[model samples]
Structures are given as C-alpha cells and as structure tokens.
Target: MGKLLTVFTPTYNRAYCLERCYQSLLRQSNRNFIWMIIDDGSTDDTKQLVEKWIEEDLIEIKYVWQKNQGMHGAHNTAYKLIKTELNVCIDSDDYMSDDAVEKITDFWMRNGSNNVSGLIGLDADLNDNIIGTKMPENLKKSTLFNLYNKYGVTGDKKLIYRTELTRSFPYPLFDNEKYVGLAYKYYLLDTKFEMLLMNEVICYVEYLPDGSSKNMYKQYVNNPKGFAFYRKELMKLPFVGKKFKFKQAIHYVSSSFIQKNRAFIVESPERYLTVLAIPFGLILYLYITSLVLHK
Candidate 1:
C-alpha cells in the first residue's frame, strides 16, 4: 500500500542539523510515511549522513541531489517526486515531535475530506516549546491572510497539504523575500478551499544563524532588488485585491524597508536620497520598492 503522508526536508549544507530531523522521523509513532530529502547541492557530508541513516533501516529515506538552486528549487523538486496523498515539510535545521506523524494521521483519518485541501498544526522550537499555541479559536475556515495577520501564524507551524493542490514557489532567488514566497502561496490556496487547523504541536524549528530568517536584514540591505521583485509579485496576487490585502501590503512594505535599510540611509546619503522623492503609502508602495532597488 502507498504511504499516506510524504514528509519532505529541503536541505542545503546543514549536515550538522539533519541528524535531529532524521532521529525525529525514526521515532514517529506512525511509520507509514516516506521521508524525502531534496539536497540542494551540499558540499558537506550531508549525503553520507543520510546514507548512514538509511543503512540503519531507521525509515524509508529517499535522497535526491540537484544544483544549488535555493529553497524554492528543492521544494519544487520534492513536490514533483512526493508519492503520497498528503505532504509536509520540515526544514533540515528543524525536527518534529515524536507523535507528530500520529497526530497528523489521526486528524486526517477522522476529518480528512475531499473538499478539504490541507491541515495546519502548531510549531515550536528545539526545546519542544509551542510558539503560537494560542491561535484563534476559529481558524478552520479563516483565509490565509487572516491566519497570519490576525491569528498570528509566526514561527514554523507545520501546514500539511494535498499533493495535487500544492503549487511551486514563484521566486527561486529571493533572499530577504523568502518568507512571503511560500507563505503567500499557501494563502492563495485558501481562495479555493479551507484548510483544517489541528491545534497540536507537531514540529520544532531550530534557530540557526545561517537560516533564512536570521539573515533577512542583511539580505534586504544587500539586495533591495529582491524586495522589489517580491513587492511586485505581492500586488499581482488575487487575494491582495481584497481590502485586507492593501492594509497588509502597507504594513509589510513599510516595516521591511525602514527596518532593514536605516543604516544604509545614514551611511550613504546620496543613495538613500535618490529614492526619497518617491511617494510613501499604498499609492506608490510598488513604485517606491522599485526605486529603492534600482537606486
């Protein structure tokens, strides 16, 4: 019989952190799942580390290698190869709780419906502490934007989706803009059907200095061009047409721009002044973003 869930880990050169993730999977209460590792051209011993685990017969591990194409590329590869009804991703630096698979599987068995496109679970840290357990009481039918803006979907909450409904990440080279990349895609899916909120802690996110979120500020400072691309794409989404989208866009752009580039503005007056004439507010949010990047 085919496995019910496909757990994928999109890893770079995080051989040091992959062990915890593999160990977590080996400890899963429900073992009827496939572990797919999409290695993004790691120069480290990642391949050998995974091979060691595979030899132990710990779990059904399948490893694939590709050129250094970034997180989105690894994700796209995993989506194409995953052969299960449901899919979930835990970063290589992160691990899941022992009963996570069991909890997710049980939730699907009891409530999984053809109309339901996916499920969302609570996420925590390396210490097994829940980050956003205090989610809104009624999240089962909330739109993707509402979940993030209102309900506060921060940290690494594990979201399980139907393999068919999943879409590829739009931007592959987005540096500071990685957060909006996949998170927004999931929200777009909410436009068609609602995802179930399991309200249980399933995964733990490790705080690695090299992790995407850690270097977000530097990414913004170095490549304002990437932010411009992100802002343009954000406006193109259909959900962004809703009233909430505009408000969220304002908040998103202003916070990211000011927070990351304040130092640059002080150090390089001419560079910052070049884009200062651009209007502030929603009418010119995309324009200002482009100016910053181009300046």
Candidate 2:
C-alpha cells in the first residue's frame, strides 16, 4: 500500500558530490520510492544541506546521523531503517538514471517474486559508457558470484535487494578497522538465492580520487582483520570451485599476515589451501605494505 522501494545512500563527508545523487532522484520518472540518507558522521555541512532539501519537500527523504563508522556500518543502519519491500544503495558519489526508478519499479512489479533475492542492474560512467560488459542477454537469473566467475559479466552492477535478506547477515565490525568487504552479505545471500539480471543502466558512477576503491592498498593495511574475515567467508561458499576458493585463501592468508593473526591457519575455513597460499600471501602482504609505504 505504501512505497515499494527505498533508494538509500550511505555517506561520509561527501557533501560536495552528494548533490548530484539528490538531483538525479528529483528527475526520476517514477517517484514510487523514498530517499533515505545515512549520514556517517560527516563534519562537513552535510546535515545542513540535507535539512534544506528536506524542507523543499520535493521527495520523501529520511535522514539519520550516526558517529563515524565506515561504509558497512552505515549500510547496517540503512538496512535496519529501511521499511520498503525492496531497497538499493546508490553511493554518495553515484546517481541514478532519469528513468531508473521507472525501470526498476516496472520490472519488479511484473516479474518479482519471493523465490529470488532481487534484481541486478547495470552501472555506467559519466560519459554514458557502460562501466564494463553488459549482462548476458540470454541469462535471466544467476547468483552475483556466478555472474562474474561463470557468466563473464564485468563491472560494478547496481543491486536491488529485498530488505529482509540484506538484514540477515550483518557485517561484523573490527575493533579499529572500518572496512569489511561489502560482498560479505551478498555472498551469504548467494547460498540461498539467485538474482534476476536486468541489463539496463540504473546508476551512473564516478570514481573519485578519495574514494575507497582508489585506496585499496591502504585499506588492506588498515583493515586487515576485516579483509581476513571477508576472505574466510568467501572461502566457505558452497558453490564456488576450488580455484576460486584457492584465490580467496591466498587473500585470507595475506590479510591474516597483515593483522598478524597467528592462528590464521588453524582458524581457516580451508586449512590446506591456506597453507599452500602462505608464500603468495606473504608476497602480497609485502607488496601491499610497500605500496602503502611508498605512497
């Protein structure tokens, strides 16, 4: 009876670029969605700006402020607060397409069901070029894991999830680390459900210089435990092949070294693989550390 979708954005001090996302929402042909902002302790004028937008009353907006926690923590908050049947995350620096809301709602209304997790849509760059290859036209549904590893789909795709599934596997926060792979929850979902593919570009993304994707070596150094936890989980996924598991084990070993976790071998979900990965992982750890140091 109410809005069927919640388009939530989790942000930090991204006030300068956040307006691009806000303006995009205002242009949506379908307004059957609400915009929820999780302000992850921005020191900038984010709160004041959002307040001004709220006063405009142009779109349904819900804003919540929390102390600085990383992106995953803000996601945890968004999942907790979203009350819609479906939800999607459009990052602070990314904006939706003009007809994105229309495409999503119309597609879901016709084809959505509880049997599937939700839909996977495309993301493009500012130049209107698809960020990577498009989804396989013949493939109607696949787990997000399979979409890349098996089906050869490339690039960052937009995910619209049922709120309940996302809330099921909340990411664990480390003592001082701010990053855990966002894919932790998504991988968990893959164990139970596959996502329907929609080859339309629903979101446009611009990778900012300060964005997390650009600073992975630093993130690896700072968030080793978090990275280890994510890799361990990925190693345990039932559907992936040994090659995939081996690769994850390599990362798990690297992260374990970074965090200096002595029990990584014993604690590993795949102990044998972890042992084999140790040499490569140590090299990777040194490589990452060197990159960070040189920077």
Candidate 2 per-residue C-alpha lDDT over 1-295 given as tens digits, one digit per residue, 9 for 90 to 100 = 6999999999999999999999999999989999999999999999999999999999999999999889999999999999999999999999999999999999999889999999999999999999989999999999999999888878899999999888999989889889999999998999889999899999999999989999888998999989999999998888888999999998999998888899999999999999999999999988989899999
In candidate 2, how many Å is residue 279 off? 0.6
What would you estimate as the lDDT of candidate 1? 0.71
TM-score of each: 0.78, 0.99
**Model 2 TM-score, all chains together:** 0.99
On lDDT, the leading prediction is 2
**Residue pair clashes in candidate 1:** none
Clashes of 2: 0
CA lDDT of 207 in candidate 2? 95
Q: List where candidate 1 sits over 4 angstroms from the true fold.
A: 152-155, 168-180, 221-226, 241-277, 281-295
Cα lDDT computed for each candidate against the true fold: 0.71, 0.94
Q: Roughly what TM-score does model 1 have, to 2 decimal places?
A: 0.78
> Residues 238-291, candidate 1, lDDT per residue (tens digit)?
655445444434434454464454443233323332234223433344554566
